[model samples]
Target: MRSERRHVLVTGASGTLGAEICRRVAGTGWDVTLVVRTRDARAAETARECQELGAQTTVVAADLADPGSAEFVVEHARATIPTPMAGLVHCAAHFTFARVGRLADDLHSDYLRSFDVNTHALLRLIDQCGRHMVDDGRIVALSSVNSVLGLPGSGAYAASKAAAEALIRTASRELGHRGITCNTVQLGLVDTPAAAAVTDAGVRDLYAMQSAVGRTGRAEDVAAQVSYLLSEQAGWMTGQTVRLDGGFQCR
Candidate 1:
């Protein structure tokens, strides 16, 4: 038998944005299943924080790049949580800096790796989780503005994100009859360790100056949006990519 509480499975729970999403949803009364590539200190801390927020939390380790990991993750969550999944938040992404024209044999591997994690894993997770989701289930995937803007030297990452958005849209249509809503949040520059790793100070400054908000995004900003998308209030919204950039694309 499943628990009466709503449960959500979150991917990439060790990262900044993912952790924030877990905390926000937990605070809003959702039990959490955190999927991490490793059950490290960071992942443990995230789970601990959620539990403190009054959520029943579980941590599972799975490298999404492995084809079998998605099935394993969904199964584990179901077994441990003993609840019908109310939502799925996919935040796992593989990124590398390589220009489309300059990608050599080794670089090509990174390109494929991006799709393996960002696109293929997402497809599998949606499929696996959808099987167990309640009728009003929510699915939210994190995308990048680069998916639409086509940032230079990020061809592989951009393409993979674009593919993810497409998958979400398709899933929304196919799953609509079941009252499941699927959507993607196209994000701008969020000030996170992952963002800092891939960009320099100069690049970050340029993005801030370009945005209408005159600053980069925060993890809380993304978390708030994810929480909303997962809420019953957003039942009518589906098959759309909501741009959460701070007006960065307006210019």
Candidate 2:
């Protein structure tokens, strides 16, 4: 007896990590939806890649940081994507640097933006996804290792991400009975557009040196772990944050 293919929605799909995840799921014959906050010039290539892998895709515009964006994401998923939604990969997040005390003025708005996209929007997406998602669905949100590691300049960002991890655990407990499993992968430093802006060469080298594997994390590496968790093999796993940090947090 085999299960049917699932519809998987991936946020931040225009980027390196999210795009790779979309490709992975689509290769498995699942219908994929890419929730893009803004149009990417490479979107057509991405769509072609997914389509070639035997998955249908629909791209929708959504800024998860916006208050009502979750509803809009869901609406677009329902109206535009061919579904029977089974999984969601929440790869969207907002990050900003603040010393927690020195940058007082940036606190309120930064906190709201962080929570809006990283925490609140995730909860909202899960809730809205419930209506269209299958009973045995899976949800995977991308989190940074900083959620627990306490990076010096990213205190608020860390807290906001921690909040998301907490919610994933709680949601897993409540939704487990419905055959739904919620999990978040706390990734270590990865070289994405987010990291590309870091001007500190020494810090960058330090991160690379810290990984047990002696290399910075890759977007695809994190995405691969997330893909497995979304598969039937991970059905027994829920209510936890899996560390995907290449042993950076091991110290």
Candidate 3:
């Protein structure tokens, strides 16, 4: 119902959850700047989809792993948008599966990379965005249920996600004076192309059964929660990590 053409920047905009968030926010008349790691076909496709949904989309290709990419994105975002960034969603993530002490070759680097993108990169982006955020700004990061549960193969991943949530909590307190709210969404298994590539079918089935809803989550489900957090209705909600696991961990 709102059609103000407010601006939002979404990292990992080419991925499944990211794309869904783009479409949903754009539908509500928000202009979106997609921060992508690569300017690939999928990135173009996502941009096209957001355009069709009536949101102006600008794709800036930069790897979040690079230390300066956050500044680069913020520069492009400032130049391209109509207003200061009103919302930000950090959905980009890097994950590698390996049990402790059974790591693959170069696994240490992989663990470092996971934290770089999932936690440190988010911190960088938040710092830049916070400096230029308009009043009532909303910031949301995509987190994982692994942060809370003792999942067998997710040690590094869990640690990185937990770190991101800590940053979000502190950020909410720091930025509240600017009327900005910061939060994270801790997600469960979602049926997406990215998840499909890494998920073992047997493990997937086990997770699906763990849900009170008796199903895995969808990208749309994650996007819907994010959209609400960005809306004016959620002004009072901040510093919280909302879990969207279909009650999977409730058992």
Candidate 4:
């Protein structure tokens, strides 16, 4: 185990998957920063969960998509710890459904907006903290399996996530020279609030069966893989995507 007590920051802390990441890392005795939107009750829940897992948590309330919120988020959290951002996990996301024909110029901009939350905000946060990144500091974003298997009405969401992964790959190359590792985890269908958006029961059933494990993914399952990627044991790994879908996309 490393001597330095790491401080990990996770955005989208109000969501199921994001909260799970906090819980898993906290259990390992890391300091956690749970970034959430102001006045969100889920934020309290996440904070409570983190504390239960035995980690000190800093609750940061900010709109990650607001202009310049990225740097602000990083700075506020950094002020809480002296460790120079030992880890960053961006689980924040936005999803909009519209077919290409219905995607007007304004609607098309939604794709960019998704990127703003899921990709650009992450990029800016990394840029602000990358230089001071602790040795082997880990940066992992929660991408989606949809990035590879595009959904018709969710193309914008998928494209944004894919772009975010591309950015991470590039960042891994740049940051590796500075002793920071960057990677992404593309999650499959998980039983989270987000899954409620899918109205097609047949599609959901099909996805559950498609997984070799014969079930939908869980936040804990994804968080377990995330914990490994953030560990000292994973120092050699970077610029990769770990799929946490019960071997759904298997060989």
TM-score of each: 0.96, 0.93, 0.95, 0.93
lDDT of 3: 0.90
Model 2: residues >4 Å from true position, as ranges? 1-3
lDDT values, one for every candidate: 0.92, 0.83, 0.90, 0.82
Clashing pairs in 3: none
List runs of model 3 lying over 4 Å from the truth. Answer: 1-3, 102-107
User: For residues 1-251, what per-residue lDDT tens digits would candidate 1 score against the true structure?
Assistant: 12356999999999999999999999987999999989999889889999998888899999899999989999889899876688999998999998887665666888988999999999999999999999989999999999988878889999999999999999999999999999999999999999999999998998889888899999999999999999888999999999998888443
Q: If ranked by lDDT, best first, what sequence of candidates would result?
A: 1, 3, 2, 4
Higher-ranked by TM-score: 3 or 4: 3
Please tell me which predicted candidate would have the highest lDDT against the true structure: 1
The predictions' CA RMSDs to the true structure, in order, are 2.3, 1.9, 1.8, 1.9
| Candidate 2 per-residue lDDT over residues 1-251, each given as its tens digit | 12566788888888888888888888875888888888777666787799999888888888887778888877877677665888888988888787877446655687668888889889999888877788889999988878877878787778889999999999999889989999999888787777877436687678878778887888789878988888888999998899887777354
lDDT of 3 by residue, 37-88 (tens): 8898988888898889987879999999999999999989889877657989
